[model samples]
Target: MAKTVNIEDAVSYFDTEVLHSGAWDEADDALRQKALNNAERILYRTYGKTYDIDDSSKWMPEEAVYEQALWMLRQDDAVQKTELGQVGVSVSGISVQMAGKPQYIAPEARRIIAEDGGSSPRSKWTVI
Candidate 1:
C-alpha cells in the first residue's frame, strides 16, 4: 500500500530535524512509519477511502496531505513525550498552569476532514 505521507514530508511539515534522523535509524523509521500509517488510517476511517483516491485524473489535495501529516507528527510527538515520562507533576503548595493539551487529531484537521464531502448524513428518516 502506498503511504499517504512519508517521514520526510512530515519533517518538512513540522519544520523540525528530529524526524529527519529517523530516515536512517531502523527503530526510529519503524516508529515514524507507524505514526504515518495511523494517521492515514484515521483519515480513511473518518472520511472513507475514496477521499484519498490516487488515480491520474484525481489526486488528494495538497492541503489535505499536509493536514494529515501534521496530525501524524503531533501524535508521534505526544507518544514519545509520554513514553519519556515528561508529564507535569503537581504539588499541593505550588500552583502550576498547564500548557497546551495534547491532541490526536487537531481541530483544523478535523475541520478539513469534515468538509471533504465524505461525511455521512446525521439522520435518516423512514415513512411508511
Candidate 2:
C-alpha cells in the first residue's frame, strides 16, 4: 500500500523530515498507520467458495470492489506525459497470406478472401 502523507506542507524534495517523521510533523502518522493496518488485516481475511456479492447468505459482508479499484489506481505512476518519445515496432516490408478455396462448388461463384477471413454470411448474402 502507498503511504500517503500530507505532501502539501512539504518544505523541500530532499527533506528528511518526511522520512524520519517527528512529532512536529503536521501529518498524523498514527491515524494513517491504523488505516493501513486495517487494510492489511482485511486482505488476509478468509473467503468461501459459495461467496456472492448479491447473496444475503454469507457471514461476512462482500469485499468492497471500489477499495480494490482505488488501491490499483494509486499503484500506477502519476506522470501521464514524459519528455522522451516511445519507440515503434520493427517489421519487414510486407507479407500476405491466402485462404484455401471452399469445398462446395457453385456456378458463377467467386470469393475474394481477405487476410483475416471470416465465415459469417452477413456480407455474402443479400436478403430481401
Candidate 3:
C-alpha cells in the first residue's frame, strides 16, 4: 500500500520529544516510510478501500489522520522490536521494565476515526 502520510507530516503531528527519543526517529527514513505504508494499509483495511488518501476532505483533518498513522507506525516499530529481541532484554540478571502491548491503532485513534464518520461495514452475514 502506498503511504498516506509523509515524514514531514508525521513529524509535525508527533511531539519533539518523541522524535528525539529514537522511538520514532526522523533520521530513519526507511523505517519511517515503512511505518507510513503499514499505517496506510491498516487504515485501508479497517475503514475499507473507499478511503481516498488523495482527497483530504473525505476523511479527518491531516493532523488527526497523521496522528493515527503515527500510532500505527509506532505500534509496528514496537512489534518489530519485540520480534527482533530488542524488547524485554535484560543483562546482569537484572529485570527490565517492558512497555505496554503493541497496538495497530490505539483506542483514541479509533475513536477519532470513528467520530470522523468512518465505518467498517460488513458485506456478508453469518447465521448460526
Q: Write the per-residue lDDT of candidate 1 for residues 46-118, one digit (tens) a residue.
A: 5554464445333344345556545555455445565565565457877443355555454666666557654
Whole-model lDDT values for every prediction: 0.53, 0.28, 0.59
- What TM-score goes with each of the models? 0.45, 0.19, 0.54
User: Which is superior by TM-score, 1 or 3?
Assistant: 3
- Model 1 TM: 0.45
Query: After superposition, which runs of candidate 1 have C-alpha atoms over 4 Å from their true positions?
Result: 16-27, 53-59, 62-105, 114-128
lDDT of 2 by residue, 1-128 (tens): 32221223222321442353332244355543443334323322322232322344432221122122223223312211111222222349554332343222111111211111312222456689
* Candidate ordering by lDDT (highest first): 3, 1, 2
Backbone clash numbers for all candidates listed: 0, 0, 0
Where does the lowest 10-residue lDDT sum fall in candidate 2?
A: 105-114
User: Which candidate, 1 or 2, would have the higher lDDT against the true structure?
Assistant: 1
- lDDT by residue for model 3 (26-96), tens: 43777767766766666766666446666765544444445555565555444767655565756799856
lDDT of 1 at 67: 60
Error of 3 at 69 (Å): 3.8
CA shift of 70, model 1, Å: 5.4
Best by lDDT: 3
